[model samples]
Target: MENVTGLVEGEETTAGEAEFYDRLRPLVASYCRTPRIERVAVIGNEPLGSSEERAAMVDSADLVFRVNGFRVDELGSERAVGRRAEVVVFNRGVRPTPWFFAGYPERLYLMIEPGRLLWENPKLPEFWPQDLGIVTMPNREVVLPLGKALGADPRAGGQWATTGTVMLWIATRLFPDAHIDAAGFSFVDAPGQTSWNHAYGDPSAVGVEHRIDLESVLVRRWIDSGRIAYHR
Candidate 1:
């Protein structure tokens, strides 16, 4: 992400690129137990700058966005991220963007319980996942309790379930008493090709953790059948 975020001198490598092979190696091993993942695409939030710059980013994402074609300027951000990444890597919990900005301490302080603090904060209500956890606020976008400056813009994904959503703030829009009743799973990791690190979300919570496990399998059949693929 240092490279992607332009944090490094010149351009080195995208953070997503560095983590790609290692992330899938374990998942494939636990599932296929042999090499299957060859090519990978590490993507980030849509670029925001000059028209040419944005166009270039869109062009490069052709392989990365198999489900979404490069949209024309006539339209706008459609469900934000286009799709839940076939594979995503989050930066874990520690947010670095706040420190860079001025007056950050006042942005994220929590007085009540973390949950209470979240709901009470005027800006943070956007981060709450809703529709039975079908959606959430985009990274860097949730209005922090103390931090009024949002680090990232809220994003949405198009899914069959959300047929008529009104594009409300999802990340900070948690239910006032939304704690679950069931016990959490004991698995070491989540099961999916998608993965993330702190940059994508809080590591302690589920956002940035690598979305794969021993049972996690990237089906080669999906590729063969022309489903769930990059570089079509």
Candidate 2:
């Protein structure tokens, strides 16, 4: 498929897409309301290693974000990774479990498709739950700017940022005044690790689409600049 900044062939904006944005604007407005978000926590799928306080800290945040395939079971105990998920960010390729879809209408769902930078409309996954309102990030508005911030060149293939990183970027952009913290990320420590230690499943090899080496540098830069308070 050809990747471009404008609409791809055979793709057209639809009413459903308009409705999705309509639902999104209000949710964003609510977050940006008076008193603003004081603290924002972004939780990754990695297991929380030996930190008894991580879960409590995550739950205490005014806004909590979790990425694809997140779980709250024994594998992802409340004592380890927290219980609240006010914002859930997922990629189109994720094969999320039933628990990932729980607590509907109460949480904000945002789908990030870096591929949408090459195409216009989003193709909903077959497993996506019906009747749920999800806001799909616009490529030009979200992905492109983020890619540039990470020093990614569009000419360089296979450099797409992972959904977790994009979620963190989104949190920083939407709630600029909020104190942002993150945990359960392993990229900084194990950038070359070939497989994932996801909270919900057996280890799986990392996909080639993500350049973790680049992502690690950006994340470390964020930590160093105090843009994010990273916990192990």
Candidate 3:
């Protein structure tokens, strides 16, 4: 991987993207309520150690952020990542499953590609029963650096950061004052072991849009800088 150096820290955004983001800021702030959160737990789908301990730690946070469709069963099993998710992150095409709506998150952060609009999707429900707020993903400004670092246009989609990594990035941007703790994300797999990527999906058919190597590179950079606390 090439050195990110000055790029990741110096994010440059076009005026249009900046204006759209500025309009969205108030919405996010209203939904998030407090600008300076104390702590947050961003849960990933990777297998974790001591599920009970991890769950306890996660639940103790001021807010819990879960990615994709991760769920917890009985609070002590491997399936139990966290009991509650205050913020749920999902990609553009992937809507939240029934379980996600039932969990009742404070906000649903939809990560969209550059030219795509969520309202245009036919998959959106006619009415959201939970009365949840919505926040667009990638936070363009925050993701700009990562995209530049990886030589990929996040808005164009295809071969970008994994949903887990995106959620991690969102947490850092949305809750700037919060100390973030992440569980269940092991960024890389050994040779020939790449098949076992997520906890629920069929390994061999896990799809290629998620660029784990690029995501891993950015993740390692964050870990090294103490930006996020990772629990493998």
lDDT of 3 at 59: 74
User: What does candidate 1 score on TM?
Assistant: 0.19
Score each candidate by Cα lDDT. Answer: 0.23, 0.72, 0.59
- lDDT (Cα, tens digit) per residue for candidate 1, span 1-232: 0111111122122355334323433432232212442222222322222344333333333122111111122235332222212211111121333222222222212111122222323232343224211122222322221121112112221111110010111101211111111001112123442433322223343232122232122222222323222121
Clashing pairs in 2: none
Q: After superposition, how far is residue 214 of candidate 2 from its true place, in Å?
A: 0.8
Clashes of 1: 38
Say which candidate scores most in TM-score.
Answer: 2
**Model 3: per-residue lDDT, tens digit, 1-232?**
2112211354334575456556654554554434655777888877555556677778777777777756554533553566666677776555444456664655555554432421235344555554665556544554555566666665565445667776776666555556778877766433223554555543443445556667677766666666677766
Of the two candidates 2 and 3, the one with more favorable TM-score, higher being better, is: 2
TM-scores for candidates 1 onward, in order: 0.19, 0.81, 0.70
- Ten residues in a row with the worst lDDT in model 3? 1-10
- Which has the higher lDDT value, candidate number 1 or candidate number 3? 3
Q: In angstroms, how far off is 109's CA in candidate 2?
A: 0.7
